[model samples]
Target: MSRRLKNNMLTTIAYVVVLLWLFPMLYMFLSSFKFESQVAVPSLTFTPTLENYRAVVTPEFFKHLNNSVLVTAGTVAVSAILGVLGAYALVYSSLKKANNIYFWFITTIFLPAVAVITPVYIVLAKLHLLDTKLALILLNTGAGIPLMIWMCTTYFKEIPGEIVEAAKIDGCSKAGTFFKIMLPLIKNGIISSALLVFIVTWNEFFFAVTATATQSATLPVYMSKFMTQQGYFWGKMSAAGTMVVIIPILIGFFTYKSLVRGLTAGSVKG
Candidate 1:
């Protein structure tokens, strides 16, 4: 085939793949505006209504939304701080077994949350932290740290050793150099990591469902209430899902450039 024809074929394939990927999200968006009676039928013939959106905006929904925001923010902040420090130490420190320590950190990421959840639950119960936002915050922060460390470490390693050496020779303390010099240079990586952590924590369901009850339930947990003995409240659930999706979408859109740059920074050594 000619090069132009091949390019056209590739573009068509890309569009098809994108539409397939977006189909479910598009369905959900359309379903959110559907009336309860029309939700049962998949056809697009029915008139759209606002009742589902209205139903999902109760005070309780707002409370759950607040809980989600708090937990996600806390998890991101804690994970970023600890991950940056840990990654820095692993890359820059002169410890004899730094590689071994880095490998150990990476191993934690492979362990499934379900495998360790029992012990975590017991510990939290003993600490009387169950059903509190703090419990979720701490759990998410710890869970997120491994990936954050991995990302930050990769980015940090890409920094030239000469820069760090220069900072040291200039009498900069390790902490000062990290905060003032290294962080600004890797700001994109940090923001990307924060966004990733926020998205993960925001949508996290297993820990939220297991560790929390009424007082600290997040948006995902709140949406679960739509399923009852009677049946699923499909319209309201769709509406809630749509609303919950907006924050992350907006964040990803606004930070798309930095996220792409940071994620791809150390991939190639050109």
Candidate 2:
């Protein structure tokens, strides 16, 4: 095939992939405006209404939304701070076994939540932290920290060590070098990591279901409530799901450039 034809083919393939990815989300968004009967049928020709959204957004839903927002925000903040510091230390600290430490962080990422749920439940029970937003925040922060370190380390590594040396020679204290110089340079990476952490924590189902009764249940748990013994409330579920999805979508949309830059930072040198 000619190069022009190949380029057109590739572009078409990309569009097809994007359409495939977006179709489900589009369907779900549309379904949220549908009535319960209409949702079961799944026909395009129907009058859209806000009834499902109205039913979905009760006081309980707001409570769950508050819980989700708090947990996501807290997890992102805590993880970012700890992860950035840890990544910086791993890259620049003069430790003999830095590789071992990094390996430990990476290993924790592979550790399944199910495996540790029992011990986690017991610990939380003992501390009387069950059914609390703080518990979810703490759990999510721990889960996020490993991922943050893994990602931020790449951004930190991309920075030249000579920059640090120069900062030091210019009488910049270690703390000043880290906060004033290094942090700004890797701000995009930090934003990317925080956004990822936000999405994960927001959509976290298992822990939210297990740890929270009602007081601290997040949106995922709230969305799960639509599955009743009578039947699935598809309309309300879709509405709740749309709400759960849209926040992250808006956040990602706003940070698209930063996210792309951060993700591709270490891909090329010079």
Candidate 3:
């Protein structure tokens, strides 16, 4: 086949794949405005209604959403702050075992949540933190730290060692150099890490279901209420899911460039 024909075939395949990937999300979004009866049918010709959205916007839903925002924001902030410092130390410190330390950090990412949940639960219960937003915040921050370190460390290592040496020679303290120089240079990496951490914490279901009750329940936990003994409230569930997805989508849309740049930065070198 000619190169042009091959390119056309590849483009067609890409479009098909994109459509396939998007179909479920598109159907869910459309169903959020549909009636309970209309959800089972795949046709898009039915009239849209606001009842599902209305049902999803109750006080309880908002409360859970507020909890999600707090937990996600707190987790991201804590993870980013700690991750930056840890990554900087790993990259610039003189420790002979820095590589080994990094390897250990990477291992945490592979550890399944199920493996540690029992111990974590016991510790939280002993601390009287169950059903509290602070518990979720702390848990998410710890869970996200490993990923933050991995991403930020790669970005930090890409920085020129000469600049760090020059900063030291000029009598800049380690703290001053990190605050004034390194952070600004790696701003994209931080933003990217924050965005990823926010999405993960926001969508986290297992810990939210286990760690919190009504008082501190997040959006995912709120949506779970739709699964009743009678049947799944598909309409309301879709509506709540739609609302839960909007913030992350908006963040990604606005920061697409920065996220892409941050993720791809250390993948190649000049």
TM-score computed on alpha carbons, candidate 1: 0.95
What is the TM-score (0 to 1) of candidate 3?
0.95
RMSD of each: 1.7, 1.6, 1.8
- Report lDDT (Cα) of residue 237, candidate 3: 95
Best by TM-score: 2
Tens-digit per-residue lDDT, 43-116, candidate 1: 87778899999899999999999999999999999999999889898888888899888888889878878998
Please provide the root mean square deviation of candidate 3 (C-alpha atoms, Å). 1.8
Off by over 4 Å in 2: 268-270
lDDT of 2 by residue, 74-139 (tens): 999999999998999998989789999999999998998999999999999999999998999889
Worst 10 residues of 2 by lDDT: 261-270
Task: Record all residue pairs in model 2 with backbone atoms less than 3 Å apart, i.e. clashing.
Answer: none
Per-candidate Cα lDDT values, in order, are 0.91, 0.90, 0.91
- Please give each candidate's TM-score: 0.95, 0.96, 0.95
- Is 2 or 3 the stronger prediction by TM-score? 2
Q: Can you give the lDDT of residue 240 in candidate 3?
A: 93
